[model samples]
Target: VFIGLGVPLYQGYGLTETSPVVSVNTVEHNIPSSIGRPLQGVEVKIGESDELLVKGDSVMMGYWQDDEATRRVINDDGWLHTGDKARIEDGFIFITGRLKDIIVMANGEKVAPVDMEHAILEETLFEQVLVVGEARPHLAALAVLNQKEWEKFAADNNFQDAEKHSEQVEQAILERISDALHEFPGYAQIYQLGIVDEPWTVENDLLTSTLKMRRNKIQDTYQDLIESLYKK
Candidate 1:
């Protein structure tokens, strides 16, 4: 086993139009959360829409024989529209979430689901939190627990009653979600949460074949569960 000691290796990002690497994370100084700094020959900038744009030699000359496609991404100034949303802090870039998946509330406050997902996963027991409340006023989440931990807790308590076990599970999930994210701002807090019996999977069409989440599919399938959780 390669027992390497580090939080991050390097931040690397690329655009197809750019034939070469745009941004690469530094191996020596690893930034845990950020994607790392831009590469030597790359120039990175963020537009008002928060989309990360790159202008560099690494950029592709243009779309392959597709003038229309080339024009949309690469402007006359030779910047590639990366179509990625990123946050720059302390001279480092961090990909918060996808621009398409970004959620903007009624009050105009923006929330990236991955940012809150990271917050929820701070606790080891926090298996997953599908940050919902898209187009709504505030944020909410559908949290799933580590089933093995939940089962072990139930067994340790010697609680054979099904009703009591269910109650304990709900209480435990809620308490952990609340305490796990105490450091977050109020709007970012999980206003409410619900639990799921099964984990997300591709077999049920809730995830991609590679195991990445298919957010829209999951949201549609669990619409009622999510709605009920937010109703309270």
Candidate 2:
């Protein structure tokens, strides 16, 4: 029972150091969220720290002009230490997140924001979302809504301007996101929402060319919005 909005998506995982692709799922063997099994001739294993390690011909020789950095990542044993924390189950690799991106909430709860963001986006109308709650009591999100969807919402709701950030709009979005997150853990649910008018793009430095979120850049760009989410 695999349902998709349109065409099915198969996730793959790799880094620049690994010639870009270490694993991929084919149409014949797709697992919704898993990154698939390691490609032929590639050996992947989880280290004691839960970091993904790769060994094989696809791995890069070394970092250019940075021997110390290269040595730190590629050990003498020829294993390329990938910073991503992941798990291997039934021959599938499920990437959790970067070692540094795990949020430690005030109550000592560990929350992986990416997992929450994925769940939030499943039913919400947002085009992009980021969960933030590093040392806070509860999580919050910065959301970028689909422009066309927002226009339709505004027209139906009798809003004079779709661009305006109104209370009615915020409440509607919160309700939708809340419904999507009902099954998530309490610590992972978003308590606040910050709506951004502009879409994240590589031109704006918010997203990489590969469409990955540049988390640090986005956080810096929306510093005020993030602070407001924490305000009483």
lDDT of 1 by residue, 111-191 (tens): 777767887788776676788877787777776667676666668766553643264556656677778778777776666
TM-score of 1: 0.77
- Runs of candidate 2 with Cα error greater than 4 angstroms are 1-36, 39-43, 47-50, 55-80, 154-164
Error of 2 at 69 (Å): 3.5
The TM-score leader among the candidates is 1
Off by over 4 Å in 1: 1-11, 26-36, 61-72, 88-92, 152-172
- Candidate 1, which ten residues in sequence have the lowest lDDT sum? 1-10
Error of 2 at 146 (Å): 1.8
User: RMSD in Å for candidate 2, one decimal?
Assistant: 4.5
The number of clashing residue pairs in each candidate reads 6, 0
User: What are the candidates' C-alpha RMSDs?
Assistant: 3.7, 4.5
lDDT per residue as tens, model 2, 127-209? 99998888889988899988787777778877756445766777777888888888887777877889998999999989999
